[model samples]
Target: MARIELLQVADAVAREKGIERELVLEAMEQAITHAGKRKYGQEHDIRTDIDRETGEIKLMRYLEVAEEIENEATQIPISEAQERNPAAQVGDYLADPLPPIDFGRIAAQTAKQVIVQKVREAERARQYEEYKDRVQEIANGLVKRTEYGGLTVDLGRAEAVIRREDLLPRESFRNGDRVRAYIYDVRREPRGPQIFMSRTHPNFMSKLFAQEVPEIYDSIIEIDAVARDPGSRAKIAVHSNDSSIDPVGACVGMRGSRVQAVVGELQGEKIDIIQWSPDPAAFIVNALAPAEVTKVVLDEESKRIEVVVPDEQLSLAIGRRGQNVRLASNLTGWDIDILTEAEESERRQEEFHSRSEMFMEALDVDDVIAHLLVTEGFSTVDEVAYAPIDELAAIEGFEEELASELATRAAAHVEATNRALNERRLELGVSDEVAAIEGLDPAILVALGENEIKTLDDLGDLAGDELIEILGDLAPSIEEANAVIMMARAHWFGDEEPVDGAEADEAAEAAAEEHERANV
Candidate 1:
């Protein structure tokens, strides 16, 4: 081809594929190199280079100067190489210029295939680089086609896919129709860069709100969290940096204009715009809106909450098919349990009676004393046993003598319970080493023994979730569980000393990575 024609072809291919012209030129050089190898001998070290400015092509063959020539085609003796260039060293490569290749029918076709493959690879790389960082942003595109219940969108620079499940329920798009979707995922696969889009993602709603609400886009108000049922209902938690601005009102707009814009695009999905609070209890209360909450009890350790509402508000609070509570749970990152007022009252009374009876039996006290103990926030015998003498004596109708007697009884009761648990653990064949693990009390040791996790190695072999399951309600939080397991595992390493929670997790992760490397 002519020099001008070479540059024109490269420029045209680059423009058409939206790739760099230099990449296209490099592919052309590679194609020509393959042709040169075919024309001469494949065994020879053939290469081709093209001048970027003038588009001049050069074909050459390289032979390495070696002390001894192993391959006659690609290597030459240092003595023979010295004749061509006296300064040539043993590792130096000498290039010999060759005539341009004459393109036969077969050679032309092979060159075209090579160039096309290289150009396509470059194009895919370009698309991946262009769209990878755009993930989580909204993309506007035209529907190019529909195949197997999914839409192939032409995004101008790249193509994207919205699977049927990712589209709003019952929403359909025909060819050439404009569609807006969230760029949820972008991945480089063998075929090309696959850009996955979605309309049902929680962040899709969040990004739509950002586009519609100027305050959110400006960072004056922020979308703290979002939960969606997709096409049916969604909830968004908004927070304002400025005290003067109401986040809910800003998101709702005047007469619900801002949120309605988003709802229309979402196939009329109902939206609940709630103001976010740093306090989890207050946040959860706001999350279950339109239905009044009578009380909220939080178990911070378990990341769970119990919401009590009026009997008539039960259905509303739970929503249809438990959607309201489900969305609230997702939004606040807490497990929510809903109960009617009557149910909560009955449960509370049952707990009070249970605690009173335990106190009466454990401390050898009367109903009045047990009731006072329960009222004074003494649920566990350990709390009474270890509590300050002054604190117990300060309770109304209780003197120092009575407080001392109660504390003595509580301590004896706790000691007896621990002794029984320890005896049971021993009977179950639980090792003393396992019992000595930090955070493993006698009750936990008995529980582990019951599950046949009787040895230190047995406890160490357990994953966090497995240990949690075996212990049931007596199980610790995941972090604490992992720490206990690691402490139990310390003897496996050179250490019998205990490690803290953070150090334990780090050690576990390092061990896991080491195991993975060994397997690989």
Candidate 2:
């Protein structure tokens, strides 16, 4: 009866804790071992084992057979060990059966505590193993409690937390309310496995759409990107594999039924399903809908775009407090600057006038000639100096002789500017070593000298953005800037000088394109 009851108790604990039967037996063994150690002697090598089929418990003291007894408690001389067993050998453990122990009140309590602690540790391990692989999955649970920091949710077999910040703005829950969230992360902590859930995660919205729209689940439509403002609004870019199916329309569903279901789940947050495009400009234009874009000026190297909208549509384009443009920027992974048509036109005129003035001063030409040069897309003296004679003569109303004269004047102006800048650079103690650096012209060298960066090491110490800031208008793209900095630091690494500016620029541009493709 005692043996049957022991097995029955172990089975009950295993079933209640949802742990393996072997784990319970192991916990029981450890508990018995602790009790035996307390009753016998703490210094003795006490061990306990239970019969798997019979539920029989055994207690023993193991003594290591040695040439000489080092400690009376755990080691025995081989001669004496052999007397007990004729085959006793050195390094072998000889077991002595210990008599069954009488369970005192204190011993029983101590054993129970040990078994409970071990069982709890096993349960925590099981929980962590089960949930760790479930990250990024949507989970449904009951709101067990609400507190100042967050809500504790009772998942069927485990508990999870939805931090205050992870909850959508103005959303609330009471006890026993059903809640669904994205399990963003699972971490094993000392107390237990911590499953962190979020209601406002961008993926949460994406997953909701995936559930509500069968086309998304079947891979007929793909979600390219998502940006959310939680309770206010969101933008999701979708692409369709089949040309016959419209990605945006499929996501919007028949009469907006699918999207409305998602909106209801998200507490009535507005959603925009935009068709994604291979062209970034087109995608960005699609992202900022309901506000027509008059023009788009993209700077690929900087991953920035200037968007021009009608003056009346400015408020709608930017949204209330800039939310629309901000969400669009987040979705497209680009910095966006919104401008009204009037502002863009004014800026363009200012640039044209500035370039014309520069040409008039540099080439010693009249405003009419300067205007013609600017209109012909000649912004710098270097461009005119190095341009092919055919290109210059091809401009309207320009002859070959006039083109040659203009090229000659442009070259002379560039030469004179370089000479003056070099003189100023020398006066500021700029080193010739800096001039030898590829991608750096005389003007940049002079700028560096003025800023107290006069040595190779000084230049090498600058980050790409810092160098770009110092170069101002002459700054190269980020990749090119980094290449230049690496060239300056070549000596530190015992490496040869890097490729010249044009080759380095080409390499950097190629690398940037490859990286962009990988990301896409």
Candidate 3:
């Protein structure tokens, strides 16, 4: 009768907590196991089991039968084990049934704690399993409490947090207020499964639109990208699979009803819906809405775009505090430089004159020849110095001999520039450790010396992005920067001598020649 009552209690607890009946029974067994250990010696290997069907409790002391008894409390020799069970043998478990423990007040409290702790662990595991796959999903929760500027939300069976920074600017919630946010992360922490919710995340706006717009929900329209200045303004780029339907119009809905619904949820944040385009330039133009673009020059190598707008539209294109261009850059993943038509024209003429001067000074050429070289897209002395004789000769008014002379002057000028830089580098007291790094040229070494980075350790201490920022135009790509930093750091591992940059090059060339000779 008592065993049946115990089974009914387990079922009731499981149904109340929305957990499995077997888990509740297991918790009960664990609690009883602790009580058994407290009653018996703590050194004894104690265990407890509760039958799932009948909830009959069984407490036992586990002893491992061994040829020699090493542990008197938990291990017994086979002869001693055979007295209790005649068929017992070495390397066998000898489970001795223990008398049912009548819990005192202290023991009962300890048992209750064990059961509660086990139930809490099972609950946390259940929450983590349920929410881990739901990351990036929108969840509706009620604000339960606020702690240190962050809100704790009750998500039905589980709880979530909206950190203060993750909340939109100036947004506040009462204890019982309902909130909708994006589930950005779920982590299994030592205390419990933590569900991190965010209202400031850019995707939260897209999810709100997804909830309100049937076209987006049905997959006829897709949200390509989203950028937000939460509680102030946002931009969303959308594309439509069906050419007949306009994605922006569909998101805006009848008389702005759909977008207004999302805006209300975001606390009056303004939204700009733009059509996504395959061309980055076209997409950037669309992203900067309400301001006309006169022209867009893209530098694909650097992922930067220069936009020329009318002088009157400059303020509009840049927005108040440069918000429009900033959001546009974020949405299109391009660094945007906004310039008025007059400003762009002035910059263009200045660049043209600068390049012409560089060609005339480096190649010892006349103005017309320099202008022609600049027009032919030879921007630097190095470009002219390395160009093939045929390429330079192909320029109008340049014969083979003239092209060869121009290349020679360009090479001489570059060599002179390097020699001056190397002299300056030595005068700055730059160490050979920094100079020996593979990609650190004389000019870059001078720059590093001017910045007080005179040692290899100083260079190696910098992150790749930090090195790029320090070197400016002299910086290598991020991959190359990391490689150079690693090369500088290689000496820290052992007594191996650092390779000089020029010596390393000669060694590589020699290896290549040896390979060719071996093949021959």
Scored by lDDT, the top model is 1
Q: Write one digit per residue (lDDT tens) for candidate 3, span 227-269.
A: 9998999999999999999999999999999999999999999
Per-residue accuracy of model 1 over 450-495 as CA lDDT, tens digit each: 8899987778778788999999989999898998888776765675
Candidate 2 error regions (>4 Å): 495-520
Better of 2 and 3 by TM-score: 2
Best by TM-score: 2
Count clashes in each candidate, considering only residues at least 3 apart in sequence or on different chains.
0, 0, 0
Q: Write the per-residue lDDT of candidate 2 for residues 88-133, one digit (tens) a residue.
A: 8999999999997888999999999999999999999998999999
Give the Cα lDDT of each candidate.
Answer: 0.92, 0.90, 0.88
Give the candidates in order of TM-score, highest first: 2, 1, 3
Reference-based lDDT, residue 31, model 2:
90
Candidate 2 matches the true fold with a TM-score of 0.94
Global CA lDDT computed for model 2: 0.90
